[model samples]
Target chain A: MEAFVTLDAVAVPLPLPNIDTDQIIPARYLSRPREVNHADFLFHDARRVPATDEQNPEFPLNREAWREAKIIVAGKNFACGSSREAAVWALFDAGFRCAIAPSFGDIFRNNGTKNGLLPVVLPAEVVEDILAQLEASPGAHIHVDLPKQEVTAPDGSTHGFEIDPFAKHCMLNGLDDFGVTAAYEDDIAAFERRYGRENRI
Target chain B: MSEPSGPRTLFEKIWSRHRVTEREDGQTLLYVGRHLLHDGGATAFDVLRQRGLKPRAPDRIFATPDHYVSTAGRKLAEIEDPRHREMVEKLARNTAEHGIRMFGLGDPNQGIVHVMGPETGLSQPGLLIVCGDSHTSTHGAVGALAFGIGSTEVAHVLATQTLWQRKPKTMRITVDGTLGPQVTGKDVILAIIARIGAAGATGHVIEYAGSAIRGLSMEGRLTLCNMSIEAGGRAGMVAPDETTYAYLHGRPYAPQGAEWDQAVMHWRELPSDAGAVFDTEVSLDGSAIQPMVTWGNSPEDALPIDAAVPDPESAADAERRAQMRRMLDYMGLVPGTPLTDIAIDRVFIGSCTNSRIEDLRAAAAVADGRKVAEGVLAWVVPGSEPVKRQAEAEGLHEVFRRAGFEWREPGCSMCLGTNGDIARPGQRVASTSNRNFMGRQGPGARTHLLSPAMAAAAAVTGRFADVRRLVGG
Candidate 1:
């Protein structure tokens, strides 16, 4: 995991709600090994024309100005279905370090945190303001400062966000749950020694 | 620290038991009681290897090959797709290397991870269960606190047998009154999703209670809990009762003899006490729920079978109306078309949501002597090899085959378009599987989520038909 403190990058606006994992990275791409570049399959069904194999012109990702955006501003309940972490990996693989939405699927949100992909929850109105700003100026950049727990808009106005303090701590230190659990190995070994005698697998 | 007391919800009791330590920041480290792994386990195993770690408590982990295994009756070596074959092979290799027990493909104990857990008694009241699939809430039917986690979390559990967590608020969903004869558990859940939008239960662990819920069989309870994730719930639970105990009394992994008596004594005390207050409360009338089916590309876009497709103009908000229009366009459905009259190209009667033996029996009764409509591609995939054998022993397979439906092996076939089983492009399918998102069954495939009986009825009629009417009940 990479430590995430602050990111200043162009924000892409995808205003649709309930963009589920199936749409993020289809199940068809799930069989491949972890090393496969999953970014290519991100929104495979929605982004490409099935008949012509060309990028769908209507999709915001296909717009030239938003092509390189590193932060995604989406509608409510983004990444809503399935527990596939491929969704987060695909976003990270595609160079998106942050996604701001009104809400997110529980597992998707957790997966993002574990992978250092910051999923920032904001009020719907605040998200709308961000999207509005992005629409007004296609390549506008937003700054997210994890240490400060604030998001600064292109106009220099700042909005506060809430994240679990432990999650924030882990993100700042590039730590994972495994690393945190390793700290208690002595206690775990003690419990296992006492409990293992009774229940043998 | 002192205990705050009034009455605790079931979720609170179970969460407290599993809590190992808590930080001032409101995050707790929870000791996982059991971990369920499926073929997706391979990916997490790859991560473990990358980190140069071994499973800390391999005894606590159980693995199975469900998602990527071919359910077309082919031997493991004969799997057509090399990628799918490699996934199953990797799972076998990893589980073996870790010395973890696996109910591999063709193992009688093997089935959909959710179905196999409770059937084998690996799930129990008061335990905290985690799996890599969203439908893991199915195990909560046994009164356990279970929810889906991502692969990274799976690897974390492999390394520590614990999860870092913030406790979720509790919601109580009370369904009262008796269901009509034709209605099943699937209808109950669909009705709940219809009443509450997909995200209505977000950030909450829902504890289902009330008369109707208590009246359901263990399988029905599982069905209700299985789809809780679809409604954005972190987990779904039903308090342990006689029904829960009877189901776990003698299963392979259940406590036995004196231990069993002691376990029941503890489980009997697991239900929420009177006057317990939930963060949110929702109640539904069971009798009013009909044989339900989804009309658009969301589980929440559901209606009674007799109802017509919704008109976007009737939506309360412009954004919802636009969403309705887009979903309708993708589903190729017209507003006001009677749900029963809409045609279907396929009928799938399997998935964690509706693949138990009871589900198979219900579908078999519908397809008993009826011939499937020409051009309809129908399949009945059992939940597990044991379920498959039980259905065969009861001749349920014969009924489905006689009705022109293909009787297949146990796996998640045609559920999410894996392992070469998928509805063709532009095809509309009536599926017992949970989700109906666009391309969920296959690219350009339209899915109308329904119960097994409704799916079987569609197989015979070539369109969505009221199961009650088909059976003349």
Candidate 2:
């Protein structure tokens, strides 16, 4: 499950920090059962105003160029609250292949990686440069070389991406949560067989 | 004598012992020994009523409301917000409707769900517990296999008292050194996260060990256990030691006399042997940590008291660079700005993260004989009403009031924005609570996550400053 990993497609500048899980997928969405089409929720809170009919001023996704963004370039400490894995599920389910940030809260990082969402941390200057580049050329795609660990922008430029060796291992295998647990299947079974019923669990 | 190859790390002993049925795919259908309930949990009970399913074992389930209860509006009858009042009303009605033990609002036994659970003995050693709250892992310090479940899974536990879980791998983090003055369990966990980066412990159950952990009080251990989620781990724990036993003695739920002695004997045997090995081992020096603060959105994006905000240029990863710029813009923080010079408009001193009595005492020491800065909007919200009353009776509230801080009642309060308590847009707040991501306090507000003492100092200074400096330096 371990290998060199890199992805560079489009630089989607979210340009916001402290984007919480509630904003990513509002709590009311949780009241509803899981569904395949949760992408509308990406900016439900942002798009609440009435003038949003034509302008859609209320949704974060309403930003024209960012509507189909698969790569998110965001501010420091993204996803700092809540332990909801659904936040990541919604992002991945929405079409985010990779998310570049200065930092992510502990639970968000784990949840993002657990679901195969790549979170790349770089120096703030380098991230800004990418944001500037995206502004210069909207809909630009970059080439991410996982083996080389670099992201090559639309202008034929490149930048390095750092990921923990372990997380990289999980993403490359496409294992996510189920994959990690399967590794110790034999021991888990043996333990349960010996102590299962009498435990009155 | 047994070979010392694998003496069974506490994580292994607990994880291996809890499995009931394992599918070939590796997920386990494990029976839950206990389920600690919180306000967020009443929704599950409501679902059960709608479905007409009775909980399989009422004795194993426990309920308390910490998230939605109003700290200021204690009397349920006085709550003006219909939604907030209805939530509390639902909590009371739901607990009784389900036959679950109810720690209704204003009950002496009522407090933060995690705080009251262990204090009351329902969260004992060797048991597996689950709650809808992430901090449910706090019970692991007592040697229990506890973790948080989602709402749907919360419903499953409510009905069948079981969870389908995939076992986590093991991570052993040992900090073997003396903690410096003013450093705390909070500092230790923050330091670990900063040192390893946020994803260092993902997909693993971390067992905290060595001198630093052993030296912690039971409450300190719980504080450390509480931040396991912040460390990207499924859970964190320390084996029950003498401190654990001492804290558990004479509590309403703990075993007494002969039963207590027997329980102690079993608890004493909880530690791993000298030669025990783990799948992974990480070590740290405790002395290196200082009173820490999260400078960026992530818990790992932290630095010591006197440091410059991270320059985006120093970010080595492409994704990192992009995110750094966004965070700085939202926070209105300029790169190269000295963290010490960053002024705060508000200082909030409460949350499940740092609202306990010990936390209050620590903050009070900073507020004693001092007053908040002219423009700082400060608050002292205790974790529970009992804590608030206890502080008031002890004059801790006076210390806070003397410091020009608003000494408020119990409830989640401003830690979350749901209670109509939030900072206005563009307000910079030094918070003693956890999760300082942009706008976490309210729309357009910037938060700097700090220790409680640090929050007090910030209140007095109206800027990020060291609490130790106020005393002498």
Candidate 3:
């Protein structure tokens, strides 16, 4: 995991709400290993016109100005379905380091923390304003400072957002849960032995 | 988090018992009792292999290949896509290498992970269960603290038999009155989502209570809990009682003899104590719930069977109006049209939600003497091999076959359509699965979620109809 302390980059505006994991990366590409670059599969279905192989010109990512965006300013409840971490992988592989939304699916939000893609939750009106600003200036940059837990809008307004302290610490240090949890192996093993012996479960 | 000295809710009791340690950052390390795996876990296993880490406790894990397995046959070669076949094969290889128990293809226990966990008694009361699939919440029907995790968390649990987490707040959704005819758990859950939007339960663990909830069968409870994620709930559970005990009594993985007596005693104390408070409380009149059908992209877009498609012009705000317009366009539904009048091209009566023997019996009863309406393609895929065998023994398959619904092998067929069981683009489907998201079935496919009986009703009528009218009291 790459530590995410701060970033300033081009942001894309996706104003649609409830953009689920199935849209982020379809189940068809789920069989591929993590080593496979998932950039091509990001929004695999939604980036195209429904029932056609052609790329939909109206999609934000397809527009020339936002083609190299490293941030996403989206609507409420973005990535609201499924527990697929592959969705986060696709976004990260496509070079998106952060997402700002009114809300997010719990599993998708948690997956973002583990995979180094920061999911920032802001007030709905604030997010709406950000989306508007990004849409106004298509190739504009937004500043995200993790150490301060603040997001500077394209118009230069700074807003604070809350995140789980542990998740924030891990994100800042580039620490994955596996290694940190593995460090407590002895304690876990002792508990398992006692738990199994006493409960017989 | 400090240990409370007073009465605790069911969720708090389970959470405290599973707690191994707490970090200064407030993330508690929880000891996982059972970890369920499906074919989607192939990548998680790959991560473990890359790290050269072995499963700390392989005995705590159970694997089954469902997401990518072909529902048309039992053989691995039957999976049309080589990539999909490799996923299922890798599950077998990974489980074998780790010494984890896998109900591989052709095994009697093989089926959707959610369905298999409860049927085999692997999901038990007071246990903290986790699975890579969102529907794992279905096991919480047995009073377990079961929830879903992502691929990275899957690898973490595989390497260490625990997960670090901040505890979710507790909610009690009490449905008090007796349910009306054809008002099954599917209807109850849909009604809940309609009343409380899709994100209503975000960051909360829901405990279902009240007389109406207690009255439901185990299968109905499973159906309700299976869609917890659809409502944005971390997990949903019903307290264990005689119904739960009866269901687990003689199952393969359940405790036996003296241990069974001991386990039951402990389970009896697992329910929330009197005067124990929840962070949030929601109550509903179960009798008011009618059979529901989703008319748009989200599960919250559901309406009663007799309702009309919502007009976007009636929306409260501009944003709401635009969202409704887009959903209506995608679903190809006209405002003012009765839900019963909407025609469907396909009918699916299976998934982790509503694919147990009880669900098949309900569908079969609806299909008993009625022929499937022409131009409708209906399929009845059982949840697991045991469910299939049970349905066959009861002759439910013949009833479905006679009614023109295809009787297929067990897997998650047509649910997410990962196994080539998708409907054609632009086709409308009456389905019994949990989600009704955009392109959930297939690109450009519209899904109307309903109960198994309701799905059968649509299949026989060629359009959405009230199952209450078809299945007379």
TM-score of each: 0.98, 0.79, 0.99
Candidate 3 lDDT, tens digit per residue, B1-473?
68898889989999988888988878999999999999988889888888999898888899899998998899988888998898898999999988999999999999999999999999999999999988888999999999999999999898888999998988899999999988899999999989888888888999999999999999999999999888889899999999999999999999999999999999999999999999889999998888999998889999999999999999987778988998999899899999999999999999999899999999999999999999999999999999999999999999999999999999998889888789888999999999888888988889999999999999999999998788796
Which structure among the candidates has the greatest lDDT?
Answer: 3
Ranking of models by TM-score: 3, 1, 2
Better of 1 and 2 by lDDT: 1
lDDT of 2 at B463: 88
Q: Show where candidate 3 strays beyond 4 Å.
A: none
Error at B269, model 1, angstroms: 1.2
- How much native contact recovery, as a fraction, does model 1 achieve? 0.58
The sequence of per-residue lDDT tens digits that candidate 1 reaches over residues A1-201 is: 888999999899987778889989889888776688878988888898867878898788878888888899998889998999999988988889999999999999999999899999999888888888898999899999999999999888899999988889889999988877888777667656654553433
> How does residue A16 of candidate 3 score in lDDT?
76
Candidate closer to the true structure by TM-score (higher is better), 1 or 3: 3
The DockQ-based CAPRI class assigned to model 3 is medium
Error of 2 at A13 (Å): 9.1
Model 2: how far residue A194 lies from native, Å: 13
Candidate 2 has what TM-score? 0.79
What lDDT tens digits, residue by residue, belong to model 2 across residues A86-112? 677677777887777766755567556
Error of 2 at B43 (Å): 4.2
